[model samples]
Target chain A: MKFTVQVNEGPYQHQAADSAYQFTKAVLEKGHEVFRVFFYHDGVNNATNLTTPPQDDRHVVNRWSELAKEHDLDLVVCVAAAQRRGIVDEGEAKRNSKDAENIADGFRISGLGQLIEAGIQSDRVVVFGD
Target chain B: MSEEMMDDEVVKKMAYINRRAPYGSIYALESLEVVLIGAAFDQDVSLIFADDGVFQLKKDQETAGIDMKNFSPTYRALEMYDVEKLYVSKESMTERGLSEDDLVVDVEIKTDAELADLLDDQDVIFSF
Candidate 1:
């Protein structure tokens, strides 16, 4: 089955990102297709490349990037949400004249239309959040 | 498969789960916004109001003092969008000392088990 996953909270601060990652990984391991993993609300924090966690802590941002690379996954961060929280891509940073871009590898910033398209195309849409 | 079978495929069951109260945070209102936008897709949609989420449908919500827009009236307009499958958790309402009379809209009250059964049949569940 094709599934679309949505995460609604930030990484580290909440268990939502971890659960969403685990769920996505498990589904892929079971030979199911993940159509897209949409990061909305504070969930867009998962796509920032600037987070520098303690040495012992899991690198949540890198984990998502690697997973997407391994499975050829579509990791989408909501543009509206990302902008609100200052998670920007190269183009956005350039457009807004910011010094740097913080979007992680393997994640693309898009509109809510992508989310709606996922709902239309996927067999199931599962959400993880507080 | 026959062309007729392919063309007449069944629509996926979509469930919108609400577990937060309105006004305190943006979840309840944002969830409602998604539901309203999703109505245009014509999918099989159902809504679940659980935990403090039951407060979202409470009657006579006064937002004037808080300086926030009171969106309780949107619940009544849901029917116009053909999005009528609203379910409220009986346990949640009882714990909060609220009855159907306190809600602004009519809803089918179900126990956790019953609600679970309903959710099990859904193809998709968007929890807010």
Candidate 2:
């Protein structure tokens, strides 16, 4: 089965991101294909490299990066939502004249078209949101 | 498959389920953005307004005091994008003391059971 997952809330403040990650990992373990993971609204916060948790705690951003690396996953953050929330990539930083880019590894910023395309292509679209 | 092939052959019934109020959270706005973009895909689309989401289509929304851009007018323009299937939960409207006349756009009102049947027919359901 091919699946596209959407996370619509920020980490820590809500459990949606964590649940989405767990669900994605479990789906892969079960030999199902993950077509894409789309982060929108506050969920874009999960793709920021600036996120740093205590040494004893799990790093939500890094967890996603590591999972993407292991599975060669496509982690997409909606560009419009990212820009609204200040989650800038190197290209976006340069385009918007910002001083820094905070997009974490294994993630790319794109338009909402990607989300629609995922819905069209994937067998199922699962949303973990608040 | 080639991009053109996918475009020509693939069509899905996509439903945008809105349950949030218009102003307090960003879900309503974010969902609207997705609906607008999804319009370009030429999929069978339906917009379901339930709970406080019915308020999003309320006529004469004034956001000046809140300093937010009043985007209620966009609902009326949705038809221009060929996104004309708009439905509201009958119970939600009644609970809010709103009627069809209160809305900016014309829409079909469905009971909870009917709404469930409608959603069950969708290929994809986007919850907001």
Candidate 3:
């Protein structure tokens, strides 16, 4: 089955992001296809490369990046939500005239239409939020 | 499913479930953003306001003191976008001491059981 996963909380501050990651990884391991992983609200925080956890702790942002690379996943951060939360990519930073971009690897900024499209294209839409 | 076999213009029954208050959290506003954008997809959409979410549609919201943008007016424009199916939880409204007359827009007041049946009929359920 194909699934679209939505994560609605930031990393470290809440368990929603971690749970979403684990769920995505588990489903991929079971050979289920992930149509997309949409980051909305505080979930856009998971796409920031500026995140740095303690050496002993798991790096949630990096984990998602690596997983996306391994699985060829589509990790989309909602543009409106990301703009409000200050998660910017090179294109967004340039367009907004910001000095730097902090969006991590394996993620792209997009509109909510992508979320709706995922819901239409996928077999199921699983959401992890507060 | 095969790529070529899937129709490019497939429509699905998508429901956006709002269970949070209008303020103190970003869920309600962001959920509204999704609903507005989801309108462009031409899917069968339903907006269900339950719990504190019913507060979002309360009429005459004064956000000047809170220093927040009052987006309640957008509810009234949903019909212009063809997103006219709005449902409010009757139990949630009664629990909050609110009535249908207090809302900014006209909506179908449904009981919890009726809301459950409505959700069961959706192809996708988005919770916020």
Question: Cα lDDT for residue A10, model 3?
Answer: 93
Q: Give lDDT: candidate 2, residue A5.
A: 100
lDDT of 1 at A78: 84
lDDT, residue A104, model 3 = 97
Cα-based lDDT at residue A57, candidate 2: 95
Candidate 3 lDDT by residue in tens digits, A1-130: 9999999999999999999999999999999999999999999999999998999999999999999999999999999999999999989999999999999999999989899888888999999998
lDDT of 3 at B1: 57
Using Cα atoms, each model's DockQ against the true complex is 0.31, 0.72, 0.75
- When 2 and 3 are scored with lDDT, the better candidate is 2
Q: How many Å off is the CA of A127 in candidate 1? A: 2.7
Candidate 3 lDDT (Cα, whole model)?
0.94
Ranking by lDDT: 2, 3, 1
Candidate No. with top lDDT:
2
Residue-level lDDT of model 3, residues B1-128, one tens digit each, is: 54721676787888999999999998999999999988988889999999999999999999999999999999999999899999999999999999999999999999999999999999999999
Please tell me the interface RMSD, in Å, for model 3.
Answer: 1.6
Fill in the DockQ of model 1: 0.31
**Candidate 2 residue A36 C-alpha distance from true site, Å:** 0.3
Pitting candidate 1 against candidate 2, the one with the higher lDDT is: 2
User: Residue-wise lDDT of candidate 1 within B6-44, one digit each (tens)?
Assistant: 343446688998999898787887788778877877779
Tens digits of per-residue lDDT for model 1, A74-104:
9999887788789999889988899989999
